[model samples]
Target: MFELTKLVRPNILSLEPYRCARDDFKVGILLDANENTHGPALSELSETEKILELNRYPDPHQHELKQQIINFRNSKPNKYTETNLEIDNLCLGVGSDESIDMLLRCCCTPGKDKLLVCPPTYGMYGICATINDIEIVKVSLTIPNFQIDIDAILQKVTEDSNIKLLYLTSPGNPTGKLINVDSIVELLKQSYSKWNGLIVIDEAYIDFTAPNGSYSQSMSTLVNQYPNLVVLQTLSKSFGLAGIRLGITYSNKKLSKLLNSMKYPYNISSLTSNVALKATAKEGLAMMQNYVDKIVEQRSIVLKKILDLKYVGKNLGGEDANFILVEILDKNGNPSNEIASKLYNTLAVDNSVVVRFRGNELNCTGGLRISIGTEIENKEMLYKFEKVLNELNA
Candidate 1:
């Protein structure tokens, strides 16, 4: 057998993970973790709450949640078409965050193996890598467009650099721009030729994208074709179930098995599994789709207003998702963190509106990442932002 420590960092190999008090007691009143002191949301099977059974262990495999997700994707008209995927090919996690950690655990050897990320993106990927003691290699995406610099990524991969995971976000977070599908396909092909690395495509915002298309566009079909490809998604965003904390990963059987083997025995809680299953029900699926439809419609209106703003520079909308990232500038054409801070602090203080300040976060020094809110909320935000701009000028 190979020495696993040689591949990972010495600290991780020697490390002891955080041991919680709840970890020991198999069955007891779970008053420690701060669960909803009341109970889960009311539903049709309200009588079930009367029968409390906290003794039995949760399913180690979480079969019901996986099957429910599989069935919902098949039966519902979500972006992921039924015929293109199956139940055995998927694995469920506490959230895609867990999946990110699992992948690092399964693949990386702390100090020896490293991972890559395109930043001005998700913080979790890098954070997870660091916690696991995996070295981080940064590849910056092109500004304004937030497209992957394919060459820069390729340049970073060398014989000495044993890169294990490459994390990518389409219609990326903070910036909200989707890398073109062709570019993703090209990166995957190159990665395969260079090393046996995994390409993780985060599709958290996929459902909100334009109908029948994604930032990476029907790339799920590629799971069967590419051995190293993985897709991570969460139930939180579009499903209106952020509190539920469930994520799904789609990949080939080999990769799926590797991830499943490395994850915690009872990673998904029994209650969470139940909640996710109910949320994927026919009615729940329909409700999610309806919500997405409204968000998309509102996204367009917000995009137009941002474009019309004099201080905001060349802004683009919906190549796929609901969030819009616009480049903002001053009358002097300089990158203005002042404008972003002013909008965030002023609007939040004056109108109790919370908009994401992405300017310095992603090296996006002059822009704001606006999430698509309800129509009324969107109009109010636009008006507030306009007032801020006028005041700054005055």
Candidate 2:
């Protein structure tokens, strides 16, 4: 029998994680964890709230939420195959951040193993690597398209056998490019055969890409085909549940089991689970689709309008996600970080419309990441943006 205990680091094996007082004694004075003895700060409780068993710990496995997620994903038409996922194929985390950290902890030995990433992508992958004391190798996305540099990635992987995980963000953060399924397939094939490292595709913005009923664009449906591939989805974006802090990962049962084993027990609170259940219900899903439709419609209109402005240059990547990555141009028709910074600050500080300034990222100089907003809000944002640009040009 293979014992995972032998593979874990000496420090981690001996380390003790902090436990709450509830872990030991749930009754009596309950002074162990230093929680407030006076009860919650709320002066009143709703009828629904009064029914909650707050004194008891939440389910560590979160079986109810897991089944809901399975049903939701399986409800979509599987473009790759007719297969459906079981609860065993899914794992829940505090957020995608936790899943990222857990993967690093389980796969990468500190100071020895490395992870590969494409920059102008999500910042967390590298941040997590740094926090875990693991090495990060960068292979930047190709400019003009913001697609993965497949050959470059393969070269890096071949040279460094210690690379344990490769992070790829589809409909990439700040880039807004939806990496093609073919490119992902190629990378997965190469990584599995060459390095045997896990390929993690962060699909956080996937819901904004296609229409309500379509699963054609998501890579999650392909998880069964490739065991080495892991796809991450979150309720934060499309479901409008960011405050609930629920993120999900889909992969093979073996990997899912490993991740579950390494995670903290009772990671998901009962309240979060209850709300998430409602959100995944039939009515909630319909409502989410309606919201997605409106956002996508607004995004299209805003993209077209922004392109018409003289100071706005190329849309840096594919407009596949809820956000747009557009270049801020100078009067001479070239990228200008100075103009972008000024526009970002002016819109935020003066007009009270905030957008991200991403000029410092690789190949993203003079870029601003603008998330899709309500129709009226989008119009107002563009009005403020143009106003700021005019002032700068003046």
Candidate 3:
């Protein structure tokens, strides 16, 4: 029911993307972009450093890397379907941040069209909207459980035709909740049909949900079914390649093609693409899942112990991600933001431990978001965190 062409901005649809030098050919003398033919300037380079493609402009389209991404995403198990997501169905960026920025520009007209984001959710969605000069509409997540309020979202979109993008996260940031498949399907049918806007789902922490491999929770599998649905993911969390700065977009050919058109000429560098390729390889995926297993196991131990502590209040959100969002207690065993703030500061400054204090966010009152770390790291964090909380309580 969603019409792709009608939703995109007129300027973006008609704009001719920058033609890069490497688009046509990668070999030969290649003087098109006016590059130095002598190669990299580093005279004394290591064996690994010497082979790095420093002098040459990286592949603008990155055909091999796209294929690798397609293979990796398609591997995530889905009972419904896995459409043949070809090269055109993928777009790579500096990070998911770049994709968010470009999506706002390509779809919404600044100062006119708007986007909707659930609060106590990821901050980047709003930040990107602000940067693009696009207005943002918010509908807070249902409390006691950080799930989307489907009816409210549907009503909001039905009333506002100018809302061009609706951003949601699976295993949501701060909340750490995975949106159910049924909820996504309902919103896609009702909200999308009425407004015909882009629904961007960020699934950065999906790997932790599954035991070791073949995670079936990814919304990427539904991309082919719902043309308007675009899933953004990154190697930063699951693959442990935050340094490579690779973010991926999976959607229908129309939306994916538009992202490719609007992105910078060489948005992904050679080093980034090379490292991402290696990370998404079969062996790399197995290793990533192994680490996921460890993290999940440690999360169980930490959550159980933390909740038993008299100073800790109710466990706030879902356990689908690598972090925990729980409240800090006052003397009467009530959730207290003041205590949470003090606990957050003391752990970082005094104990040499760091955890995010998400007390200000809606429904996250008195909450401290603690990340699941290595066995040794978690042990130390637990010892230091409990010790600090006790001191603050006393």
Candidate 4:
């Protein structure tokens, strides 16, 4: 019999995780785990505060929240009618961060296995690999367009069997481009079968690709067909529920169960589940769509206004995501990391306007990542940006 225990490190195999109080029983006094018996210290309980069962342990499975997510995904319109998913195919995490970490823990043996990632993408993928002591193989994305260097990725994975996971961010961070679905499909068909490794598509900004109830641009529907594929989504971006810290993973039933088994019990708190439930409902979905529409509209306005600035150069990405990555040019019309860093610091420290500086990232030599904000906020950001540029140039 091939046992999974052999894959786990000997130290982890011998270890016993701390058992929380709620692990024993959910009802009848719940004295097993050491919790505040007298209730949390609060002079007055609000409506939501009164409703939450802080005394009891949260549902380890989060069945109700999972159902809401399943329904929400199915509610979206895709080209194929068979895009429906069930609870078996879904799992919740503290955030996509947890899922990413757990996936490495479950599959990659520390110091023995490795993962592949395209550079100038999400930073967490590499950070998590480093934390786990897993080797990371970097294949930089093609410059200018910020698309995957498919040939290089295929070559690396084929040559190295230790590579167990591949992380790709659609609507990539810093670049703000959507990796084309065809390019991904080609990689899956041509390369994934050869290595038998998992491909994780991080769609944190997927909702910005289209309007609500529409997922034509998302690759989530392909999960059902591709056993090796895993799609990660979050309520943080378009849903506007970052505080609740809810992230979702869609994968094959077997892999989903394995991830669940390895994850800590009660990872999702009851308070978070309650808030997410309301947000996934019909009324909440409509409200989220309205906000997305306005953001998209403002994004166009911001893009145009930034391009008109004398110091701003070409926008680096496809502009599919909610943010814009614009190059900062020097007086000589060349990309200037020094000027970009200066402007980023000036805006954040003095003007109270915050944006990311990606001047050091690959292919983004002099880039500033500005997220789409409200109309007034966008105007203010541009004003501060121009002011800082003029001062520096003067």
| Model 2 vs. true fold: TM | 0.89
User: Candidate 2: global Cα-lDDT?
Assistant: 0.82
Tell me the tens digit of each residue's lDDT in model 1 across 287-344.
Answer: 9889989998888888887789878876632345767877667768666888777877
TM-score of decoy 4: 0.91
The estimated TM-scores of all candidates read 0.82, 0.89, 0.97, 0.91
Lowest lDDT block of 10, candidate 4: 1-10
Off by over 4 Å in 3: 211-215
- What is the model-wide C-alpha lDDT for candidate 3? 0.86
What is the clash tally of candidate 2?
0
lDDT of 2 by residue, 1-394 (tens): 1123443445555555545555576577665655555545567877655555554556677777788778877777446645778888888998899998988897789899998999988999989999999999999888778888889998998888788788999889988888877888888877676766788999998878765355657777667778878899899999999999999988878677777776787788878888898999888999998998998888889999999998899898677788898989988888999999999998999899999999999998899999999988998998889888977877
Ranking by TM-score: 3, 4, 2, 1
Cα RMSD of predicted structure 3: 1.5
Q: Is candidate 1 or candidate 4 better by lDDT?
A: 4
Per candidate, the number of residue pairs that clash is 9, 0, 0, 1
Clashes of 1: 9
Candidate 2 wrong stretches, greater than 4 Å? 1-42, 212-214
| Candidate 4 lDDT over residue span 308-369, tens digit each | 99999999876778899999999889999999999999999999999999989998989999
